[model samples]
Target: MSLVELIAQADERGLAAAGVSCLDRCVPLLGGDDEVLRPLWASLAEDGDGWGERVAKIRGHACDAATGAGAEAVSGPRSGPGAEAEAALLARRMLAAVPAERSAGALREWADTCSVAALDIHRLLDVADDGNTSVTDCREGRTEGMPPLVTAELRRQVTVLELLAGHGAAGVRQALEVSAEGRRVLQAVVSRRARGRT
Candidate 1:
């Protein structure tokens, strides 16, 4: 069964039987590769339309599963009377199964670096996705006359990316570079839009 199917069935059966109150406990059993249910995702991914979203979800769930498994390795079905222990065990296995490489370290690093600045990579992603590069109202194409907040945020993001440019996370740094490029692109688009608007 696929991870989604397993989760849906468990939800249908109810949390009492599923013992899945939190994402931590719920994700371990998501259908995928042999023991991991990862394979199921690959099959689903072959469809391709919602690939990035699906993959993001899969990776997030996998990370959650690793956390669940680390809490406890549930051997059998929990449903009903045996739910608490089963939940704990499930969490253990889920937590344990997550590999260290799949976004965890980089995300942790990124989050840590950006925490003080409050300009997380996720925020960078939001900017990239939303097509906003305005130093003032990023989404609104208000670049030439950006507010203090937007410019500060942009500068902070740029600084962090520059810092992370080296280190071991080349891919992450590459993404940062891409987002920086995006900011430049957005600046241009917003400039054009602003010129048109004005």
Candidate 2:
């Protein structure tokens, strides 16, 4: 199936296949348009009109990938090219792109909310070989009622992705100006990654 098809299936079949909350979660991750991932994402978003089945396949495939099933998780019908898979791939790609500090916050406040309509994304996103992130990261180390990982860089990245994907506000320009806090967070991720390389 495809992402669009999976969306329709959710609408038609209820949770027997994919739950409503599951769909809500993936929307935020699906929206980001970093220069690194835009070209790849554009292809998924533009899989032609009436491309429902195509989308369903993507979601199923993505779910499979998350479960470590490789790409053979959900197979049946080609769907509309790889638009759904591409969207799914781009979502994971950008997720990997996130600055570590902000991942927990973005997932908690916006992406993981019931509003996004996809909980599976959060489940997969929650899975980190690095450590028990996602939900716990948002909970365990909160400071002043704020998540320790919710740095300015994470917020900016979330904002940028939300805006670019047209999932937030009336415009996307909000995420572009960038912020001092965001810059510092990104620098920190880069610095940390650099150190790990050595």
Q: What is the TM-score of each candidate against the true structure?
A: 0.20, 0.27
Error of 1 at 180 (Å): 21
Q: Lowest summed lDDT over 10 consecutive residues: which window, candidate 1? A: 11-20
Model 2: per-residue lDDT, tens digit, 47-134?
2233244335444444444543122233332222232333354345433322222222333332323212222222222212132334
Clash number for each model = 28, 24
lDDT score at residue 182, model 2, on the 0-100 scale: 37
lDDT of each: 0.32, 0.31
Q: Write the per-residue lDDT of candidate 1 for residues 107-178, one digit (tens) a residue.
A: 333232222222222123232334243322432223454434345444434333333333323323343343
Reference-based lDDT, residue 62, model 2: 43
